[model samples]
Target: MATVTYAFLCSGVGLALCERLLSQDTERLRLCLACRNMHRAQAARSALLAAHPTAQVDLLQMDTSSIFSVIRAAQEVRLRYDRLDYLYLNAGIMPNPQFDMKAFFKGLFSSNVITMFATAEGILTQRDGVTPDGLGEIFATNLFGHFLLVRELEPMLCHAGRTSQLIWTSSSNAQRSAFSLEDIQHQTGTQPYSSSKYASDLLSLALNTHYNPQGLYSSVICPGFVMTNLTYSILPSFPAFLWTLLMPLFWLIRMFTNTFTLTPFNGAEALFWLFKQKPESLDPYAKYHSLTSGLGNNYTQPRKMDIDLGTSESLYEKLLQLESEVRRKVEEKKKEAQHAHRHLAGSVSS
Candidate 1:
């Protein structure tokens, strides 16, 4: 049997999907936790090992928000593994989120209440910043960094006879109108999170178009509205105690819409489900969603995405261009630092 290697980006402690995925078949998986913080990654590894003493779990230091970090991490991964079977692009961020209480209250009384709750449309906005890579933080963390990593690992992912899977954690909040090919980074938008996710959905389709022949497959999944750290950050003013108190109300909302998969384990259903599927048999145009019924049963379902081949291909080209530019900038910065260091050394010697 081929040793199935699974590398998860940004999945640490409290990440329900990582825990659930490991619980299913710890003995079968060769799991690698790719995270920005080594301390947290160590903790996550220890926890997993505690649960399954014989499970193979490793760690890689990677910060998806930083291009330099991603590049270095990808190099390390290439050194460690001969072939990668599954790459989970699960690292994401929604910075400086602001919730619109007025809109939420008004929508509660409107006919579109269910829609509002399901998608959180018009109910949330976020302040985005540029990363050191000169890319939008949301765009870098949610999509571009993962894109770069995939490109770097193409050699391992695309082999002669074996197939590799790229699964992205996308969201229902991904809106068609929010993303623009010209502003692929969403630099000027308050909905950077939404725009970034929409771009991922588009990029996944494009990846399938370009890499499928090379034995690499790409797919997107929505984990629904799970009350993870990302979700809690939306309403930072709401104390953890208050959120705990509101659990009953959230459950009531869950009854109205199955998208209210309030827990991380439930939110990870689609990701775990996709692990069992044949990549060729899956629909490239569909977004797999983790849903929960009123009785709290978890299941995965596929919903047709709003993306088309033309837009996907267009976005893919734009990303490749950006990738080239970013790499050039990184190289130039390295050269400048080297020149400065040499100048200082010469002056000191004189």
Candidate 2:
């Protein structure tokens, strides 16, 4: 029997994974639902317990946008649990998403939206927002925060197996082209969400290089474009609702086409598919699993690009530097906190 923890970001997706894992066997998997919101985390916990009354479910606040939040969450987990098997970096956001109208309509006719998003992908976000950390929200949630979380929780994650796996919930929408080397946050007129996702893809690949030998295995998952709540942000709310009504048909088209995977269950195809294997055996070619029409319903298709070992390595090094700097900040704050506590205690005694 194997003990596993499904560490995920999104409450909905995390719950979905928990439901599937729990349905199998109660004693096999331990679930820790880490979300940005505590109220939502409590609600998710209640729902999970309602279904599986005896499930080992715990809730912790893991806001990836802030390094402090990540460090705090890691500390909380250390206080409670011992070893962690799976670290699913499944929390990401396309904040203030805006569809490229020109590309959408054009892609609809050419049926290229599938390949376009998969291979030479491009993202259009004509909107603006900022995170509490002051970095671009999309970048912070999608890449940087996860980066910090991985750094903070390295000790637990490395305890999974002789070869512990770091699973990154990446996407086919990740574009090597849209991502700029200089501006990772997409400060200029670029799609920051896509850039950040691309950065993560590169970062994941990079992690495998440096960490795989250290008994840590890293793999990135392309959860083909599932009709997640995250995607609804791009369109007018009503229109998006109408569009979802036709989503099944679009999925049907993808059944035969190898380029697609439909539904959250299906979108999770790659994540589930990869779970059956050892991390050391992962395809360096970046094994992509998809569903095709002639295939009935299977996740065994491959597209080009999204596997740059070099870029991945570069991103990994960059994150290491960021982690060092962030940890220093945490230690300084801890020292200040201790100083304040000492002063307060002295005043109390006086």
Top candidate on lDDT is: 1
All candidates: TM-score: 0.96, 0.86
Q: List the residue pairs that clash in candidate 1.
A: none
For model 1, the superposed segments whose C-alpha errors exceed 4 Å read 12-14
Report the C-alpha lDDT of model 1 over 207-301, residue by residue, as the tens digit. Answer: 99999999999999998888888878888888889999978988998888899988877888898899899998999999999999999999999
lDDT of 2: 0.70
* Candidate 1 Cα lDDT to native: 0.89
| Per-residue lDDT over 22-128 for candidate 2, one digit per residue giving the tens place of the 0 to 100 score | 77777877888898888988898888789999898888887888777887898888777777777888788776666666876677578566665444344356454
**Model 2, stretches more than 4 Å misplaced?**
1-3, 111-113, 116-123, 126-128, 159-161, 290-296, 300-305, 331-350
Indicate the residue-level lDDT of 240 in model 2.
58
TM-score of 1: 0.96
